[model samples]
Target: MAEISQVSLGDAIYDRVCQDLVEGKLRPNEKVTIRGLAERLGTSSTPVRDAVQRLLRDEALIQRSMRDVRVPVLTEAQYLEIASIRRELEGFAAGRAAEMVGPKEVRRLKKIVERNEAAAVAGRWPQAVKYNQEFHFALVEAAEMPILLAILSGLWLRMGPLIAGYYAREQLGLVRHHQAIIAACENRDPAAAAAEMRADIDDAKEGIIRYIQSFTIDE
Candidate 1:
């Protein structure tokens, strides 16, 4: 019974840390310690250690020493590689979502964009970043493509920290492409939806490259 409980606790801890990565709660290159995370989460070190191990394996976290673990910062090449892949996969998901999206889903997406815009304007960058992720994930989920969503989630786990760094450094104007995507979904135009999704992903390229360069300079 104790062993089973520990296993469950480990899984729970793993998912909580994953949310931190996926939601950009952690920043790129920020150092992490099991003791700190355990305290922050009000848990023991055992489960936190287990969860951090999984993130390390996922390449979401990099270990610099026996005790030093930090979020991995992507290079310009790495970021672009992932972004290119995202354009294809997420664009396909958006196209499929356009095919299946109903009025309710369209409204939900619009609401998400609205919230994201508001957060951006208010300079609540973390909130904006979270809503941005929510909007993309919502679009993919609407497609009802479980396998695609799983693949995208892995990509996002790597991107979230890097993206958060960008957002913290700049203002957001990416919503125009998102709005275009919403319009394409409203029109039930799969090609337009896919194109707009690709555009949105493309828009990130410049900002992410700039951010990556800054990281390189800092390091």
Candidate 2:
């Protein structure tokens, strides 16, 4: 077996926990016990606690008590609100990236988008989730705007559970959305890029809202 490389314990624990949450292994509204989580991750309670605290702050996990946490359920309204903000922010980032993107960054973004599309087609939900995130973050990083990146980072965390739901349900054509956005980037058209970004996010928001509404009506 290959040895696991050592890294920052808190970050390591957080990434693992977040992956589980996004991949539906750690389900929404399910309780998370720090000691149990730590044991499962093959780490100590300290790092797990830190990771839980961060997740709580991110609203990915809600603090139910002093030592207890649960994955927060996504509401329809909250999903729409988060998606709206994310679209605006991501559109701004995309426009900025279009204006400032160099050949190297454009190539990088293309690769990320291509990988995301492949994952979506292959039904590799986790890889799709990872690559979609990488594509957006790569665009923001290309702009060299730390403040914008920070804002988008907060929004992404809030959207994580909802995005996980989208992947699991598999309702929309994510690959097509990504392909359009990549085409805009390739053309170096800021307005076109922003428009594509907004469309992609809006489509996702609609799909999630419709899904949630069906459940609500059923209830």
What lDDT does the true structure give each of the candidates? 0.90, 0.74
Query: In model 1, how large is the Cα lDDT of residue 56?
Result: 93
**lDDT of model 1 at position 108:** 96
lDDT score at residue 192, model 2, on the 0-100 scale: 86
lDDT of 2 by residue, 1-219 (tens): 122332377888888876666444564556799889978888878778888888888788887678657776678778777788888888988887778877898788778877877777788776777777777778889878899887876666666656766666763455566676667777888898898888878777667776565443111
TM-score of each: 0.96, 0.81
Worst 10 residues of 2 by lDDT: 210-219
| Per-candidate alpha-carbon RMSD to the true structure | 1.4, 4.9
Backbone clashes in model 2: 0
Highest lDDT against the true fold, candidate: 1
Number of the top TM-score candidate: 1
The residue pairs found clashing in candidate 2 are none
Per-candidate clashes come to 0, 0
lDDT of 1 by residue, 1-219 (tens): 998998899999999888889999999989999999999999999989999999999999999889889998897788889999999999999999999999889999999999999988888989998998999999999999999989999999999888877877887664888898999998999999999999888887898888877764233
